[model samples]
Target: MKIETQCLHEGYEPGNGEPRALPIYQSTTFTYDSTEHIGKLFDLAAEGHMYSRISNPTVDCVERKIAALEGGVGALLTSSGQAATLIAVLNICSAGDHIIASSSIYGGTFNLLDVTLRRYGIECSFIDPENGDAAIEALFRANTKLVFGETIANPAITVFDIERFAKLAHRNGVPLVVDNTFATPVLCRPFEFGADIVIHSTTKYMDGHAVQIGGVIVDSGNFCWTAERFPGLTEPDSSYHGVAYTRDFGRAAYITKARVQLMRDLGASPTAMGAFLLNLGLETLPLRMERHCANAERIAAYLSTHQKVEFVKYPKLPGNAYYERAMKYLPLGASGVIAFSIRGGRERAVRFMDALTLASNVVHVADIRTCVLHPASATHRQMTDAQLEAAGITPGLIRLSVGLEHIDDILADIAQALEQA
Candidate 1:
């Protein structure tokens, strides 16, 4: 089936004359017929769920749906997007490991890797994606376990070169992890371009209504874990009774370890109710993304020519920096988000956002309702001027997230805001 059909029918299958909607398996524990049967589950010999902390029927369905959408072998749902990143890295990396990440990632993720992960002995080197291949590759060392980058960067509105990065990682015997949150699977499936792992914060377009907070990690099951490279997977895991992941689970070693080991200890599993809502969002993703792209293209064109605007950045827009890469990766469109600079600097940008009536000046992005944010002052306020430049953030940059609203109304709001600015 195509992605649109898979979104609606991939994971859950109904019995004869049963309910069509995905059911929420609300129980915390499952019952077993005999003690010996339960023992097999505890020993990993059986695949039945015994605790909600590890898995649930409802959440499992969502995971499967996401896995199908991303063309991955398996997926794991987390309580939030942040947890997904943490688990995705920790599954392979240890205290002394290193990660090479693009500097254009979301600010929250930047802090997580540069500060929190460093606290745990995991060090990260942030490199600008625009840097030449040699400069970026030189950051990799023997300790480098993986390469991390965003598919369509958050506020920067730049697209990462997935095929290049994936090749760079594969050459160094490391997996390429792509955060495809902004450009949902409907627009671009990173796995098709050699990405080994894919991740998303379902709080974004996946849950278009902004109802639930969730995240998903999908493994393509392509990367091999040799003892010399990824000892964590090829070596015996003592916590699971000397079980080696690659030896037993084969293609699913990476994801299985994330669940049986990481999830078992950290417990960042999503609630069954959240999964139900996310499924609802996934059902309409294809339709909503079409409208989002259409509206954003019109808005970007308007912003580019406006008297009060300095420049506009939308990968789908012609003459934009990432238009070529976007055409290669996101032929459908570059999702809904766009970035533009008001003529005046920070003060003028804030003035324009405040003047808007239809579009909200909120802290959120990728929602069904149009929203705007000033990253330099709001999201990336903590960054110094030098740091902001490195992240492709200008003081006057306005991150405008186009919504599914009608083109006329959305344009009218922007026209009025530009007049005020």
Candidate 2:
């Protein structure tokens, strides 16, 4: 089935007398008749959920749907996108390991890698995506485990060259993990372009209604894990009674280890209710994304031509830095977010946002309702001047998340706001 149909029909199917809508299995534990069967589950020899801390029926259905959507062997849902990223890294990396990530990622993610993960002895090197192959390649060390980047970088509005980075990572014997939050599967499937793993903050496009916060990590099952490079997968996991993941689960080793080990211990699993809501959102992702892209395209064009605008950074716009790359990767659309700087810098930017009557000045993005944010003072406030510069951020930068609202109204609001600025 195509993605549109898959969104609705992939996850759950009701039989004979069963309800048509996906049911919420809200209980925390599953019951089994035999003690031996429960042991099989505990030993990773069975396909059943024993505890909600590990998995649930509703959440499992959503995971399967997301995995199918991304063409992955399996997926694990988490409480939030942060938990998914942390678990994805820790599942394959250790204390002395190194990570290479694009400098233009979400600010919270940058802080996670640059500060929190460093405290645990795992070092990360941030490289500019446009620094060319040689510069990015120089950051890789023998200790490097994976290459990380975003499909459409948060707020920066730059498109990541997935195939280019994937080749770089593969040449160095590392897998490439991409954050697909902005360019969700509906827009771009990183796996088709050589990415080994894909992740998304369902709180964005997948949960278009902005009703829930969730994340998922999807394993492409394409990376070849060996004892030499990934002992965590090839070696015995004492936590699971000495089960070697690669040997036991084969293509699903990485995700299985993530679920049974990291998610199991960290307890970042999503609730069944959350999964149900996410499924509802997924059913209309293709439709919503279509509107989002159309609306954003119009908004970007208006901003680019506006007299008060210093510059516009929408990949779909002609002559934009990432226009060619976006055409290749995000042909369907560049999602809803647009980044443009005001002419008079930070003060004018704030004035414009404050003057807006329709668009909410919220700290959120990709919601069904239009919103805007000043990243430098809000999301990227924690970053140093040098870090902000490296991230392609300026004092006047504004992230406008174009929603599904009528284009005329959104533009009218922006036009009035710009006049006030």
Candidate 3:
């Protein structure tokens, strides 16, 4: 099936007389007549959900759908995108290990790597993605476990060179983990560009209605886990009856370890109802992404020509810094986000956001309803000046999330907001 058809039919197929829609399995525990069967589940020898904390019928379906969409061997759903990132790294990394990440990632994620993870004795080196391969290659330490980047950065709208970075990571014998939140699978699949792992904040574009907050990590099953680099996968896991993941699960080692090990301990599994709502959003993802791209292109063009706008940073715009790379990585659309600054600084930017009547001023992005946010004040506020600059956020920058609303109305609202500013 094509991607559009796969959106609706890939995850859950109705059996005879079953409901056409994916049914929500709300119960946390499944019944088994034999104690030996339950033992098999605890030992990782069974293929069933033993507890909701580890897996669920509804959530498993969504994970499978996303894995299929991303062309991954398997996936694991998490309570939020942060949890997914934490587990994605922790699944392969431990205390004293090192990580290499692009500086242009979401502020929250940057904090996770820079601040919180440092307390855990895991050091991370933030490299400029614009820096050439030689510069990036120099950041890799002997203990580096993985390289991380975002396909399309949040607020910055900078396009990451996925294939270039992937090759660099492969050269260092580390897998490339890409955050594909802004560019959903409908727009770009990082796995096809040599990413070994793909992650998404399902709270954003995937749940188009903004009804639920969720996330997922998809494993490409392409990286080799050497015992020297990833003992957790190649060596015996005493916590799981001495089960060596790569030896036992083969291509599924990464995701399987992520689920049974980190997820089991962290307990960040999504609720069954949350997964149900996410599936509803997934069913219409292809259609929604198409509309989002079309609307965003027009908005970026309009903002670029505006006198009050300092500059527009949407890859769809001609002559944009990331245009060529976007064309190579994201041919369908650049998703429904644009980053631009006002002529004045933060004060006028705030005024513009407040003046907007049609677009919402909220702490979210990629919703069906249009919204705007000032990065320096809201999302990226915790970052220092140097960190903010590294993320490409100016004091006057506004992150506009173009929605499915009619372009004329959206443009009219922006004009009025500019007038007020």
**lDDT (CA) for every model shown?**
0.93, 0.95, 0.94
lDDT tens digits by residue: candidate 1, 1-421: 9988999999999999978999989999999999999888878889989999999999998899999999999999999999999999999999999999999999889989999999999999999998998998899999999999999998998999999999999999999999999999999999999999999999999999989999999999999877997998999999888889999999999999999999999999899999999999999999999999988998988888887888898998999888999999999999899999888799999999999999999888999999999999787887778878888888789999999888899999988887887
lDDT of 3 by residue, 1-421 (tens): 7889889998788899999999899988999989999999999998899999999998999899999999999999999999999999999988999999999999999999999999998999999999988899889888999999999999899999999999999999999999999999999999999999999999999998989999999999999989999999999999999999999999999999999999999999999999999999999999999999999999999999989999999998999998999999999999999999998899999999999999999999999999999999988999999999999999999999999999899999999999999
Q: Clashes in model 3: which pairs?
A: none
What C-alpha lDDT, on a 0 to 100 scale, does residue 382 get in candidate 1? 76
Superposed by TM-score, candidate 2 places the C-alpha of residue 388 at a distance from the truth, in angstroms, of: 0.9
TM-scores for every predicted model: 0.99, 0.99, 0.99
Q: How far is candidate 2 from the true structure (C-alpha RMSD, Å)?
A: 0.7
What residue pairs clash in candidate 1, if any at all? none
**How would you encode candidate 2's per-residue C-alpha lDDT over 1-421 as one tens digit per residue?**
9999999999798999998999999899989999999999999988998999899999999999999999999999999999889999999998999999999999999999999999999999999999988998899998999999999998898999999999999999999999999989999999999999999999999998889999999999999997898999999999889999999999999999999999888999899999999999999999999999999999999888888899999999999989999999999999999999999899999999999999999989999999999999999999999999888899999999999889999999999999999
